[model samples]
Target: MTSTRTRLTPEQRRGQLLDLGVRLLATRPLDELSIDVLAEEAGISRGLLYHYFGNKHAFHEAVVRHAADDLIAQTAPPASGPPLERLLTSVTAYVDYVIANREGYLSLVRAAAGGNDRLREIYEEARAVLTDRVFREDPEGHILLDTPAARLLVRGWSALTEELVLTWADDPAGVTREELLDLIAGSLPAVAALAR
Candidate 1:
């Protein structure tokens, strides 16, 4: 049997490579991904992967960036709603995303904690974007709401949420999803208290 590969535009080709990288990263650690294997899977040569990304590190960064952007977009709440309602919606979406993308989530977390500085930066960037989105349109518009202390509190809460998701991913049966959502949602008051 014979197979044929379709020609793709530069942008389409790059996206295809990144999508493949994300899929592979989900099931395997970054270091385990290889140009040869990825190329073979994509029906291209190893040299072609480098042609698109320049090198492995660049490819990894691109994949990480794409994942971060996607996660942010996927979890963003509706533009208008009660703060608490919006928070719950966003948090639930986050939990669902983490559960659905366990390997991808774990790979990113492991990379960040395992001393991969670029991955860590990407992780931090994602957290910041989440924080900004959550606070960007607070209806209250109180002077203290967007203060530096408040911003830090949001960042800290986001870190805590990450840990919670990681733990929940390890043992879904240990805590019901409702309980997981409540735990993260319940922490908002404490976060607010700190900001005040």
Candidate 2:
């Protein structure tokens, strides 16, 4: 690959690399990402790429971490809102993000299910962060989700939401976004009741 040097500082260059990796994840599953291709896309040498990231696994880990941070930041709800409204806001943001970045979101799911331990950890961490945020504001303490039962319910709901969002993204004819949202929102009480 041809290399054209840029004047970006080390940290800026690393951030640029991470950004490119994120874009690449949008089109390819994590396991399929090619280091050579990444280096080429960045217009940098493989040696230079390794200088920034020790190896492909390191690169993947950085990308996963970056994606998780973005996912959480983009979907964060207003802290002052009513509990249900905040949850709806968060869920809506999540569904919107998945719809807008289907390939990337699916890549995360595929990585988690494909036995990539690091990716699985990052994915679960992201999910747990969101689940905790959404349930922490429960007015009736129905969805506080601190107990084992509540935690399990939240995890199940998260899985269900991911499946529904992916399915709807793949083929809207099966279910509209609003319908999917309704189903997700409707399940909250039942899930919360499991805690009680």
Q: What is the TM-score of each candidate against the true structure?
A: 0.88, 0.86
- Candidate 1 overall lDDT versus native: 0.82
Give the Cα lDDT of each candidate.
Answer: 0.82, 0.82
Measure candidate 1: CA RMSD.
2.8
Alpha-carbon runs more than 4 Å astray in model 1: 1-6, 141-144
Which residue window of length 10 is worst by lDDT in model 1? 135-144
lDDT of 1 by residue, 127-162 (tens): 888888766766583223778888888888888999
Query: C-alpha displacement of 194 in model 2, angstroms?
Result: 3.4
RMSD per candidate (Å) reads 2.8, 3.8
lDDT of 2 by residue, 1-196 (tens): 9999868899999999988988888777776776798899988899998999999899888888888888999899887766777777888999998877677788888778887898899998999898888556655633455777878888888889888888878788867778888888778877787678
